[model samples]
Target: MSRLLLSTLVVVVVIVVVVVVVVVVVGVVGVGVVVVVKVVAAAVVEENDYVWKNGNHAEKTYLFLVTNTLT
Candidate 1:
């Protein structure tokens, strides 16, 4: 009787863990999709290719230079 109860408890724990994992994976994938879509949209509208090494990003606003002063 004790063995059966232990086995049932283990099975329940495993099911709960599986559910939590599935939910987390789905949430992560959803967020990734949104980010990719935004990046693609930004890439389409912007002229310069952007990356981390270029000090460029999809979220940055363009600044038009109006004046320059040098000594």
Candidate 2:
């Protein structure tokens, strides 16, 4: 009976650890995506002279700017 209980406890501890790890990884990735989106938006705003009404392809615009700067 004690061995059975020990096995059950180990399983529960492992499940809890897995859950915590998944949550932490997902949270970090989520924050990183948000930061990247905000940075791109800010760059677009600057390129448009602080106006956010440009109908152009901002992602391509930024890519072009980066490509130009690299070469």
lDDT of each: 0.68, 0.82
TM-score of each: 0.56, 0.69
Report the number of clashing residue pairs per model.
0, 0
Top candidate on lDDT is 2
Please provide, for model 1 over 1-71, each residue's C-alpha lDDT reduced to its tens digit, 9 standing for 90 to 100.
99999999999999999999999999999999999999987875463334223644442333222112211
Error of 1 at 41 (Å): 1.8
The reply for model 2, stretches above 4 Å from the true place, is 50-71
Q: Distance (Å) between predicted and true CA of 55, model 2?
A: 14
For 7-71, candidate 2 gives per-residue lDDT tens digits of 99999999999999999999999999999999998886586563334435785677568757976
After superposition, which runs of candidate 1 have C-alpha atoms over 4 Å from their true positions? 47-71
The 10 consecutive residues of candidate 1 with the worst lDDT sum are 62-71
